[model samples]
Target: MKSKSIGLSPKSFYYGYDSKKDLKHLVRLVLILVFIALLTGMIGIWVVYRSAHERHLDMLRAFANTQGDVLDAYMLLDEVKSGRVHGDTPHEHNLDNVKELLLKQESFLETGQLLLAYEDTSTGKYILIGTGHMPSGQHSVLVVENTRELTPSMRLALEGKEGVLEGQDLHGAPVVTAYLPISKHNAGLVVMLNQSEFYAPYHRARLITLGIGVVFVVFGTWVIWSAEQKNLRQVREREQLIRLSFENSAIGKALVAPDGSWLRANKSLVNILGYTEDELLRMDFQSITYPEDLEADLDHVQAMLKGEINVYHMDKRYFHKSGDIIWSHLSVSLVRDEQGEPKFFISQIQDITERKRVEFENQRLHERLMDQLSLRRQQLDTASGALEGFAYSVSHDLRAPLRAMSGFSQALQEEYGDKLDDTASDYIRRIHRASTNMAELIDSILRLSRTSFGELNVVSLDITAMSKRVVENCRVVEPDYPVEVRVAPGLKGQGDLRLIGSVLDNLIGNAWKYTHGVENPLIEVGQEHVTLSEQSDDSVLAFYVRDNGVGFDMAYSNKLFRPFQRIHSDREFEGSGVGLASAQTIINRHGGQIWAQGQTGKGATFYFTLNHTQFDSEKNSTS
Candidate 1:
């Protein structure tokens, strides 16, 4: 039994409904297939064109090689005729015969001209000896006695290598060339074909392939259009959705007219500026921009309009509706119409007021920190001056008593040496030695203080000459001590002359002292390449003094630069243990580092840098 209809009849309900959604899916599938077909066609075109171009290049290379072989044979024959071996230079008459053969062979070549050139080893010039074609109407070959710039292929041939290169010929026309050297004659043969003619066939084939691809694309587009026309109502629905998305975007987006007037703005933009849509629509960007920032913003906008730049981003300030300033990062891009004329600008903005506030606070803190640093620097200067004064006082007031003790002890030894007992004489000698050691310690302290306090006098110094003079002084001071010193020549650096001289004296003296009692004592000074922690390149100069003398254990290397830290006893080394320490202090003042490497009873090498710019106190001296 038929039931009573609850709503409209079935035919009425289904009327005017054609399921256009399914139609859209079908159209999309068709379009995709068409695109694949078009892509395949285009790829085929590229493969054909590339294959043809390579084939032509290979043919040219083969022809060039054959011609080169013939030319080499002719050159060899000429050399033999001139009563010379294969490698000897050919005579003028032999060169003339080779030139005639080259000119004769040029007619047989299908698409290229030939040239013979020899490189003048003395002048580094490629001198043309022969050419198949003469200069006419800008189509020319290099002439005899005229120079030609060497191409990569030509340069390789000059070095007795064969190669091919694509480059510009002498007439500045693009060409592909093959170069082969005539080994015995010290010359080369070059075959050049115009690139335009070489690629003409390939270009024609590429055009045909592209034409087929275009036809397929056009037909696919027609099918898509016809199918799309049947879905007008669905298209309208999509348009509404797009509009809604534009209005509800989270980012502040706007379309501004070329005249800087707001054409459309999203809800996010309205919320950012605290302005209603109606209010914003009536205002232009220039009206709300902070006065100081408007000029720069306008300059970028004009530049975009003139095509100097495509897009720009700037941090800008705008007046809010409530009269407060709002900071934002504004990114703008110019949009053009189909005719390529200025249409409008698409702008995206993000609020940056919080970031700006943090930046301002950081700047304030930085200024405060700089002020504190300046105040501390002044205090340090005052303290350093006080210390310098104290050192000077110690130098004068402390040395006077030590001198008296030394003088009295020496007087007793000389005046009463025979009368005094042996024990008494021994006590007197002990006092004299103690006084001398104390005097040496005092001198080292004063020198260390001076090096730390004085300003550096930097200049270009001849280090080798300075080292030689220091060695000379050492020789005169200790004539009996047999020592051999070798100073490397041409060693120069930028440093203070007097201070660096002191550094050399101390180092050389230590080397001379330590090498005592050894057979054939030797010292050598030279420079080496060094790498610093902060620099990636190993270009730092490490000037070193090496000696074959009695060396200390590596375990004590850390204490080598500390004052009063001695590896050997006073009787063994006869030093106050302050010589190396003083040397280190001088090097440090010159913005340099000093390090030592040694093995027990073997030898020692002291390496240092003169232009180091960093000083870490932790690494400067040993505990």
Candidate 2:
């Protein structure tokens, strides 16, 4: 005969046809659990209720203190109206007014007394008007709601000695009390309270706890019994089942020697090492585990033994019966004895070789895809370089001959005017002007196309000095205006220098042109650090060329950066409408962006950002 334990818990195991023992054990376990839970819950309930009542008592105390001050005013009135009225002093006019005020606040005094605990020793009326003379050379105060209960210690208080005493009042209450003696002007006050009120909540709490404890035991037993029946549902009652439950339970069900030898394992665990059930029972977990995984598993098992982590899952390779490596997801837990120290290891294993293979394939594919993407980007940059070469040739070579043709045609008209009629002369002048304009248009397009290229020589360039040079060129173009220029220092930026310089030329030149209408114009070139969004992680310097000049309408700001887009006519401000487009292309080439803001009659400011990585690269390249 074999004996084993069984309850609702997996921690329990049934042995050798003892259904009666199994059911009994289950009932006992649930009862114990329910009892513990009831104990904790009842204690919590008691604390919460006690805290609530304590707060109520505090509110009571605060109300009493507030009321005492109100009653004190009435006492002051009494002192004034009845001031030493022993055939000596008359009631003053101020005293009469105070007496009236006291009558006015009588209702408030009545409501106040309702919250306080008191007994008047003078007349045995707890709320009657009583007297206490202020020891500060003032008349005696009329006291209300004063305690009158005199214990053995306090009854003697009127007889002239002062001491703390505990005794029953006229109401037969066992109370704690205090007495203050007043020999002068024949007056005294007694303070008392029944001690039972403070302990009432605690006594009620204990009673509730006892009731819950009994109920818990009964309910817990029923739950545990039901749970046991549910567990037995899949267990077919047969001789083999009775044997197999003890022999082949899934969690490495085993009985082992003190030396850690295996005594048993289930069919599920037998497959873990590609061995038969009989073959595995002779081998411990350490015998099959690879040397590399053995130490880690043992350390984890030690931690489980010390109750650090209750259960641990590990992926480890083990030598099977045929010396083949088999990967398993091993879960080790303790099989405890009656005294609860670990007696044997119950190691659960799940073969996961297929899953590992899939993961390795996915990781390799990801690396391949990343390499392909990088190669594709390099190819695209190379292609964009070839396009830039074609554009530069088209702009420089094609436009040079066009400019010469425009100059010769204009010279032919001026030098050979007598050889032509009015219609022919006008036609030649128009042809020359058209050719010059086309040359300017081609120049603008080439500038825009070159900036659009992907190949960029990014570096930190002094934008302050760059702006000053652009202003100097603007001055050479328009020396009559005598325009002012202000460039910010510490205004270095990260970008392709040639492209960024083109952007400054367009922006600062636009500012200078717009301000030409002003008799004395002011142009400001400045940069300030800023964040585009209030909560954005990106931070950058906001560089702007602002001018005190004629500005465009607010509505047309969106068209400013668009290619071949213009807000003003060529006649008003002679431009190809491609300057802003060229500027945007340059900024975009350096991984930055440009935008303009202006109001009707207010100056325009252009702002943009470069990446922090670009700034660091610029610093390194310069050094």
TM-scores, one per candidate: 0.51, 0.45
Runs of candidate 1 with Cα error greater than 4 angstroms are 1-250, 257-261, 298-312, 321-324, 333-344, 372-376, 400-437, 457-462, 490-494, 527-541, 589-592, 611-623
Candidate-wise lDDT, in order: 0.76, 0.63
Tens digit of lDDT per residue, candidate 1, span 1-623?
11112222322221323446656776787778877986887787778777876777777767768877877777677777766654434444565677666655534344467767775555555556434344542223354442336556666676787767898775577878877877766777677777777777767777876787678777777777676665655755665576667678887888777778776777999999988776776778899998988999999999998999999999999998888898999999987766887767889988888899899889889888888888888888878898888888878888999899999988888998889999999999899988888888888788877877777899898989999998899889888777888999998877888889988988888888889878899999987754555556434568889899998899999999998899988878877777788788878777788888899888899988776542232225421
Q: Across residues 207-291, which tens digit of lDDT does each residue of candidate 2 receive?
A: 7776876676666666766776767654535545765775565544444332345555566566656677667655666788889
Q: Kindly report which residue stretches of model 2 are placed more than 4 angstroms away from their true locations once superposed.
A: 1-379, 400-417, 529-541, 612-623
RMSD of each: 42.7, 35.0
